[model samples]
Target: MIGVLIVLCSLHTGFAVTHTGKGCVTGSTGVRDLPEFVAVLMLDEETGAYFDSKTRELQIRLEWALNKVNDSQKYIHYFNVLISSAIPDLMNALQFAMSLYGHSGGIHTLQIMLGCEVSEDRKAGEFMKFGYDAEDFISLDISTLAWIAHSPQAGIICADWNNHIETAQFWKGILENECFALLKKLVEYDREILERKVPPEVSLLRRDPSSPVTCLATGFFPEGIVVSWQKDGEDLHEDVELLETLSNEDGTFQTRSRLTVSPADVKEHNYTCVVDHSSLEKNIIKPVTEEEIKTNQDPENSLPVGIIIAVVLAVLLVAIAAFAC
Candidate 1:
């Protein structure tokens, strides 16, 4: 017997330019620490609304979300009613999944992720997927409007759902039209904040003089930027690793590029970290010098002089770009 079970959908939101609305519903049983049922809503990867069985209420996470809606209270009430009506069906589905898995007890979860996105090119797409125990069980093919099963147990479920063609059509309409429209409206309501650009703070970091040099750029907006390492005015791709761009808590971005070279060789050659972004008039070029490398050995006073000047210039350039925009 399984002692407890919980399931939740995997959700990743988009950048500021491409607006989106993501929602997930979860059902669980015999979980002391978790709610029996929970639902969450996100706009552009930020929590816009939330609900749980304990509260039985649709609550807003962002204040501006309810401002532009024509019938604010009615809209809130509609979601409350919708989620309340959906809970029983969700519970039944959870039990059916548990039975299929042959789990009589323990913590188990069934999660559903559904969302819509409108890209910068105005191309729009939607998705709906189901998971059990944090693994994919089934997903909907928005292009064909059919369910695709990922596991043997989901085959029967998909077959049953596919028979109801009208229901699929109804959800398609809601996702593409209703959901897309609401996401676009939310972006419109916060255009100023969404469109604003903030420059990155660049730093050169290393564990010690013998360690690989790492160029860290953080707190930039729009998520579009380039980081490269150059040696003596030539591109140096070998022994250089450029990491993926990551999102910051404030809706900004951060990235890193590391260069591996012996300390003696680094001193002989001029290695520079080049950063390019829309917010800058010119690319930021910082040479890898011992004086400019922040070290963990003396973190408190290790602020590099080169990085300090680069940050000041970056702010001025970003200010100029903002004025031009």
Candidate 2:
């Protein structure tokens, strides 16, 4: 996995305006013995894109965003080139770094992170920017070759190729004009898709006659769902265990709540599983009863028993025909 941290801040009308963007590139060997890349780009934690080499698809906001673009083929081509061009260099750098560290052969990761932070006040302006490969500490400055930090070679690298003044000025322009411009465009494009919500598929299950009653909610999007157990129209807090929300492969979420009840209590009180989510206009309430439990536990028994009687009658008719013949 690749991790990048970026921070940009500006002073406008006596308030600080901050913008951040992160880009990640990950590569792994696949079944075809070829390297595969997964590239993720994020802007201010609101808009993001993921390109998967194995699927050859680019997904944005849990949907295929490439199809929505005007020139989808061109967009795909650009992303493919951007990701594929970086794989070999990154892998080679990682292998070299691993050798230096005395590590051999298994899956290794090389990460490159680029960040820029600028903060300004009335009297002074400050800017910080860095790009580095995490594995070997080979880093980049505005006008310097990749050099190991804190090593003897670092002094030579600084003296020979340092262009701190020009590099800093260029980065300032890029951060304000290019990076922030892309962020604004992405946020505007993805506004509607990001706001879309999906309702939860609520279900109640009792796997065995003696097992605890489980209330399951799956396929819910946006992650702000509440599942609770209620008895006789009142919420029950005791003897209830709620599991963590787990992510589905399709970008939805699932969670379950377990309620422990004695046989006497089950007979005496009515139980229900209640779900509340933003997607639902009204709360969903699914009542749990002894009959529902029995049905869930033994659903196959509900098939028609008359089919057996019909088979027996058919067999007798055949036997009588045989005897007459």
Q: What is the lDDT of residue 239 in candidate 1?
A: 96
lDDT of 2: 0.49
User: CA lDDT of 263 in candidate 2?
Assistant: 67
- 1-325 in candidate 2: lDDT tens per residue? 2122111111111222333344444444322543344445443333245555566554454243344466756665665665555555545544554555566766554434332322221112222221223233334443333233544433443343244444334544554454445444543555444346789987777776577888878877666789998999898999999987655555567788888887678888998999998889999898888655532541121110000001111222221222122
lDDT of each: 0.67, 0.49
**Ten residues in a row with the worst lDDT in model 1?**
303-312
Per-residue CA lDDT of model 1 for 183-220, tens digit only, reads 67666677765677778888999998788888988888
Candidate 2 is scored at a TM of 0.56
Each prediction's TM-score against the native? 0.67, 0.56
lDDT of 1: 0.67
**How far off is residue 86 in model 1, in Å?**
6.9
Looking at candidate 2, what is the lDDT of residue 78?
62
Q: Per-residue error at 282 for model 1, in Å?
A: 2.9
